[model samples]
Target: MSGETIYKGNKKILGLTTLSFFLTFVVWFNMAPFTSTIKEALNLSKEEIGVLMSINIALTIPARIIIGMLVDRFGPRKVYSSLLIVMSIPCFIFAFGTSFMQLFIARAFLGIIGAGFVIGIRMVSEWFPAKQVGLAEGIYGGWGNFGSAAAAFTLPTIALFIGGENGWRYAIALSGLLCLIYGFVYYRSVQDTPSGKVYERPKRNGAMEVTSYKSMAGLIFMTLPLYGILGLLTWKLSNTSLINSSLANTIYVILAVIYLYNVYKIWNVNKEHLKEGVDKKEQYSFRQVAILDFAYLITFGSELAVVSMLPMFFEETFELNIAQAGMVAASFAFMNLVARPGGGWLSDKFGRKKTLMILLLCLSVAYMGMSQINSSWPLVLAIILTMTCSFFVQAGEGSVFAMVPLVKKRLTGQVAGMVGAYGNVGGVLFLTVLSFVNPSLFFMTIGVAALLCFIASLFLKEPDTAEHSSIVVQDKAGKEAAM
Candidate 1:
């Protein structure tokens, strides 16, 4: 039998994948550094500023589910390019916003771009086969995630260099231009799959599928956090009090109803198939994917939450200049270019479960070390402690995706979307935790979450080779060479 002509797994795919993220990420975090300028220009309060920032991520959870389905149907190239064009208008509105409401709507529209990350995972999976997915995903995620840091480093510098009250608007508008130009360029250069192969779509959509009624039931339960996190953000608004709680109550009711419907839809779609039993499902377990999804919820989630707060915590606690503090906080993200790829390569080589277990343990230590920080402690030590935490943080990111591409072959996009969304959910919950808690405790709480997930990992079985066999595919080029 001839091996299939799967993705070329070549440099061209890598270049396109990186470029896709670079464009998407700039637009995603374009609001961060410029928030002060936006607030001052519009005469907004800190509370309003906080809401503006939160709104940017608000739409992404649902957007991922929607875009994931779309990507599986239409393919990544169309979905990503189209997302960039539509999202540019929001970037322009955000750049030139005259009021908090304008900024709020722009930020909400910006959530559309966050779904850009999902498109790449499916695209990258198409290019790189199973053996290399870990490293490819690591490179993709580590580089892609660093876009936030890019906004931090470049936007402020651009704002400063432009040397005027309106410098931020220019900086923000620059992102729109990048998105506009790159959208066209990306379309011209990339294909859904290399040469002749057709990109496969999933058998179902709406909710991720599980083989058993129990796991299907669990999948329904898992979706609650996505909505709960949104409600948690709603409460964080200053006017959102418990007594006038009709909106929150209504949202909760809607979420619960949606979840029940989702469970029914998942079961209805898969019930006949499950009764027939998995044709190839004698092997594999959805339980493993569920655990990893939660594991990532804590690991990558903590990373997002920590990175979100670290700059502010460091600035106030250490009494450092804003410049110095931001620089220090940035070390956490900069670790990604190395730490994440290292995690993927390590998992690919050593063992997936062992690497993740070891990293989670180290992550627990890093968080523990961070919780010990005080004004009396040396700054170098504190910095080292944060970077130590970052290594495991990014490594956990690598480990998570390492398993993502290895899950049920056909459902890889759906699985990646759920796991990816959990990372965002982690950010929301951790930052919400930070609202009432102190910084050290904030870091420690994440540690506690990681430890719980780590304990859960103790039950996770390393993915077996046969797991990929259900959707059988082979590399045609390899087969041709062999013949």
Candidate 2:
């Protein structure tokens, strides 16, 4: 197909996939708007409310990894639809659950829906060529991510319109129902790829395949932080009284065993390929994946952490009312609509490595500047700094994923999963840091992390794509290739 024809035909599929992802996020974060209502209804303590907030993201880290593998195995069409339909069960349960345990269990399961982001990464890469995939993926990511903001803005008023003690419950359940119906619509509306195209499948499935034993070791080393972050979350649960100390200790031991078992699985999957060595044409550095992991940890990860705390930061630092503070803090997330896609377009115009390096360096500097904000600073200036810092942070995220699918076409799901999980790891760790320090130190810590990521980006090798086509086509050129 010609490039113009391809763009026209595939535009519909892109819209459908982005809409599916947007609805999933709408359900994933539906709980946030009703926090106050839920707290009042349940007569819960502040600590319990905090635990519920934390629970919403607890399952997402591992879910992304598992979902990534599933996307590669079953294709995004089936996986995305299935996830949407199945997660509705938990969404409805959280909406109407009466007890703390009920709400906790429901919210934890609902976290799996956050993995919807990875499925679309593979789907969009299939529809768009390598040259256009960055901006395409950026649109998928940026617009779909707006579901959270949409939920924040709309759900509360929706509940108010419905009116009554059950108003919030009904509002949330309505979103669940809509998402559930859209799951089937999405399944019928979209295919895995364009007509006559064969979807690429990885030869090995259970664990990620690494070409070299050195990369294999790096993969194992990187896996530790996923489990470590989970452990940190467990400790947070214990402190919040959501679980007893005994139960928390038991869970930690189980997590350790799971980590070791996972190590064995990684070895089992890659040992054969590593021992004999792979074909020269097929080999790619695993270090690229590792660097992107840290890159996302600081970028998207800090974005999550900051979004949660920024409202409070504004309220306290500038002595603004809750509404004013929320509006000002919202400038950070609001940047997603443009900044993320702009980052990807920059990567497409310039080189991917150069764009990512520049974004991370600016991100580091922006955060360092943010660390110096205080009551003495003008409120308008602080808001400007916040939005400016946010642009680099989100743009850095777009740049990271711009290279994820380029790593290994078949392993894109798993690669995206690992990199995406580290984003959450950054969130859990950074939030833990916030628990002990003030806002200034929190910003400084993230500044330092972004600087470290900037250093690591120096080692990222640009994908050698001299042999590939620069435009969309149907044959081998259609395969997800590096740039």
Candidate 3:
């Protein structure tokens, strides 16, 4: 298809997919806006509340990987629709949950919805060509990611409008209802690919395929950290007395076994390719994926941690009321609407590698400036600084995914999934650092991490659009046909 024709055809698909992703995030984070209400109503301890919060994100790491595989095999339209519809069940359960255990189980199940972001990565890549993909993905990500902030801003008013002690429950349920309805709407509205274009699938389903022995080894090494992060989470729960020692030990063993199983799958998936070696045209470096993973780890990860803490930081540092503090903290998230898209536009207009390197450098500098904020600083100046830092952080995220779809066309889902998971890993790691340190120190830690990512990003090779097609097409015989 011509660029103009493809652009016109994909407008509807982009709108629907972005909306679907927004709703999924709303449902996924529904509990956050009502945490205080739920705690008081259920008479939960602080530790229990902490556990509930942690559970909301715990499953998402592995879910992204599994959902990536599903999307690649079944197509994003079917898998995403199914995910939205099925996840609403848990949302409803959590909305009406009367006990801690019920809420725990529901939140854990709802974590899968967080994987919805991965679906749109593959979907947007399929629809847009390399020349335009960065901007398209930036729009999808920046706009869709605004859902969490939307939930935070709107759900409170929604609860007040319902006007009862159980109003929070109703507000939460409304998000689920929207999700259920949108599932059908999305399934009817979008196609997996443009007309006459074939959707490529990976040769194996269980694991990502690698091109060479070294790439295979790198893949395995990277996979280990995911399981390790889960282990760290379990250890934290045990240390807090959230789980018994025996249970924690059991979970650790299970995680180890799963890691071994994943290693085996990685070997199985790439063994033949390692022996025969893939064609130069077909092979892309796993190192590219790794660098993106680290890049996202700092960009999106710090975004998550900062958003969670910024409200309190503002309140304590500036002596502002809860309302004022929350408003200021929100500016960080609200930047997604423009900042993320701007990053993508820059990536498309300039070079991807240069855009990312510059953004990462600015990200580090922004955080370093943030680390110096204190009560002495003017409130307006602080807010401005916060928003400035947020721009680079989110734009860095835009730049990272802008290149993700270009890595390996068929494995785009899995690659996006792993990189997306590392973003969460960064969130967990940074937040954990916050638990033990002061706010200023926490910000500095993030700044330092961004600096390291910037250094690593120097090695990123820009995508050669002249040499590689943005989309991969296959013939009926399972051979690469066109791009």
Question: TM per model?
Answer: 0.91, 0.96, 0.97
Per-residue lDDT tens digits for candidate 2, residues 1-483, read 554545455778779999988898889889888898899998988888888889888899999999999999999999999999999999899888999989989989999999999999998877777777778788888889889998888899999999999999998998899889999999999898766456778888788888998999999999999999999999988876568999999999999999999999999998888888799878989999999999999999999999989999999988999999889767788899898888888887787899999999999999999999999999889988999999999888888878888888778899999898889889888999999999999999999989988999999998753422233235665554322
- lDDT tens readout by residue for model 3, 147-218: 998898899899999999999999999999999999999999899988657788898879998888899899
Predictions in order: lDDT = 0.79, 0.88, 0.90
Model 1, C-alpha of 165: deviation from truth (Å): 3.9
- Per residue, candidate 1 scores C-alpha lDDT tens digits across 419-445 of 878888888888888988898888788
Question: Which regions in candidate 1 have their CA more than 4 angstroms from the true location?
Answer: 1-9, 159-164, 196-198, 238-244, 281-283, 465-483
Task: Give residue 294's lDDT in candidate 1 (0 to 100).
Answer: 83
Candidate 1 accuracy as TM-score: 0.91
By TM-score, the better pick of 1 and 3 is 3
Candidate 2 has an lDDT of 0.88
* Candidate order, TM-score descending: 3, 2, 1
Clashing pairs in 2: none
Better of 2 and 3 by lDDT: 3
